[model samples]
Target: MLDLFGDEDTLALAESHRTLPGRFGAGTRDRAGVLSALSALSQQAGGAEFGIVLGSGFEGAPDLIAEIGARHRLLGAAPETVAALNDPFRLAALCARLAIPHPAITAGPVADRDAWLVKRIGGCGGSHIRASATGSTPPGHYLQARMPGRAFALNFLSDGRRIEPLALTEQWQAPSPLRPFRYAGALARGRDEAEPIPPAIEARIAEAALRLARETGLTGLASADCLVEGERWWLLEINPRPGATLDVLDRRPTPLLLQHIEASLGRMPAIEASPTDATGAEICYAARTCPAMPPLDWPDHVHDRPRVGSPVARDAPLCTVTASGPEAVTVKEELRSRTAQVRTLLEETENSHEFQHERPEPQRPGGTAGREPRR
Candidate 1:
């Protein structure tokens, strides 16, 4: 995955690992650095089938991919589609034209700031969202009226002509003083479970996905976020890229990326039988500044780990914890237990006298802390 977080350990998980600092896109100031990274990725991917772009840093994916001068195919939507969907105002307009129900959205700086939210165009994680009253009408920002409901997302594949369901995930966020509106994790719905959304509402989502794909030239793997209220639902945004929830939903015998490639080539594969168990993943963030993050003999559930003695600021993620069970309750409990244990360990590490005596090195710039490690 061409994203911010590094899965250096998971190079074996896939053929390519063209990751760069994408946390905030600040550390990557030099155009030369990005060019160098892509050049290296291409070199590593000799005779490779294609290149896939994921995550928020690629606001200019169309331009960047073109400039990178890739030799292989580029999977996912057209550059024009990506650019159009990245703009919330344009997206809302599209939703209106398609009769897709969306939150009351308008141009920047609404008069009733308290009732709306300020969100960044092309923003991925919830981190870029802010209460309208607290935010200015900055460039690339728009307002959507705050809707009361739990957050949910649907992962689907499109073959330019048809849409296929992949999975439904419940999105979680832990807003705090340090990392307000932080993406905490997502829980995949089980086969024998009740979805947060009703069947009728889900049908609307499927219809919307197909229509959006038809209008926007969206193909390959993508996700659509929504706010579900009882029987009614409002569309939040559509991400026409490989999603972070793929880890939980992708259970086909064939690798999901291959299917993504097939979809891009205008083919929709039949959904194969897979795991019926509920799977959930969470991002465990540091509650306080930890000067020393010693590597622990983490259990098998842990992934996307930080290096030992890594100085993590308060609210930055330490690692990801995943659990599987027959139901969401058990999976959620397991995640909570593991997350609490890790947080305790982090607190202990911070209090150690070795940590106090040790002079920690400055953190690397342009990293997502611990969020969105897709590889």
Candidate 2:
């Protein structure tokens, strides 16, 4: 049952809509319409089993009867390897061949002027990124070497030799002096209630992500992005798909999408540990209007309640409000007073749908008023 980024409301809240058209790049004539919709959902679920690809979301498609370790197949580390570890320059050459402490790269393409970061050696979420300067090239490229600090993301889940550290956020708006990519909020929490990942920089980013998943033998879900500095972290890329907080591991307690379908059937299950102290938060706010129609109207002192019509654009994602308490300023003041009541009901329903279509009320882009101070 091919489900390349399946989205029938996340397979009706996760039932099992499996598919892996390289992970979501339904092009090339939608790859025979996703192999005829995975041969009619595999005769209503009887055959067809393993497959998981994510990196440039399945560019060409076809080639996945069983292959799951993305970043385009982690440069073929084989474990039933499918194909397509496409870009990010092989995750910065597997973190400099596992010396891990990345960020100081040069790969291919870039002429040098002063500041560099072209990105798209097969990008993700923060799509087609750019941040040039060092001899600015900007014309279909790949010139990284712009890593300074303050940008954190580490969502993990591996089985090729134990590795499950999930939740450690702060990937707010990338592409500014090199946040590289990821341009929306994600505050997740609990890493000792966060702000303290320095056990030798989290054991050098978990030993360079288990040495790039034991030299690319990558197993289920993976994510990494670091740059810390001052207790040092560095290593910037490596995302074998299933992250954008993968629904914050679906409020964990064992539900990382059903542990990526029970680790794609091999079943290594058992992953709870994410509360050395327990505290949670997730904030994603963006506006420029166009928040997809809805049966709107929500404001009951917002708390753990948001999923009204979803589908917002202007670079994807526009509403995520999570909040958990027990401390950490009571879950950041209940996710800052319920994301300010969902930003005043998305600015009064986009100013009453631009005054009933007569249009002309847009003029509010000056430093987003107040109340964004819960860092």
Q: Which candidate wins on TM-score?
A: 1
Off by over 4 Å in 2: 1-94, 97-115, 118-130, 134-154, 157-162, 165-207, 211-223, 226-247, 254-296, 299-318, 321-375
lDDT minimum window of 10 residues, candidate 1: 22-31
Top candidate (lDDT): 1
- Candidate 1 residues 1-375, lDDT tens each? 444444324544655655555454221223456778766777776756356544445653456645543534567676777767766777888999999999877665566678988776666567677888753567766788899988888889898889988888898887877346778888986789887688898889989988999988888888889989898888888888776676677666788878888888788877776568999888887777655556456677777666554456677766788889999889989999999988887666556665543556333344335343231
208 in model 2: Cα distance from truth in Å? 3.9
Tens-digit lDDT track of model 2 for 117-212? 666443455535566655444443567677677777777766666666776665555333333454544556654554545666776687677777
lDDT of each: 0.72, 0.51
The stretch of ten residues in a row with the least summed lDDT in candidate 2 is 364-373
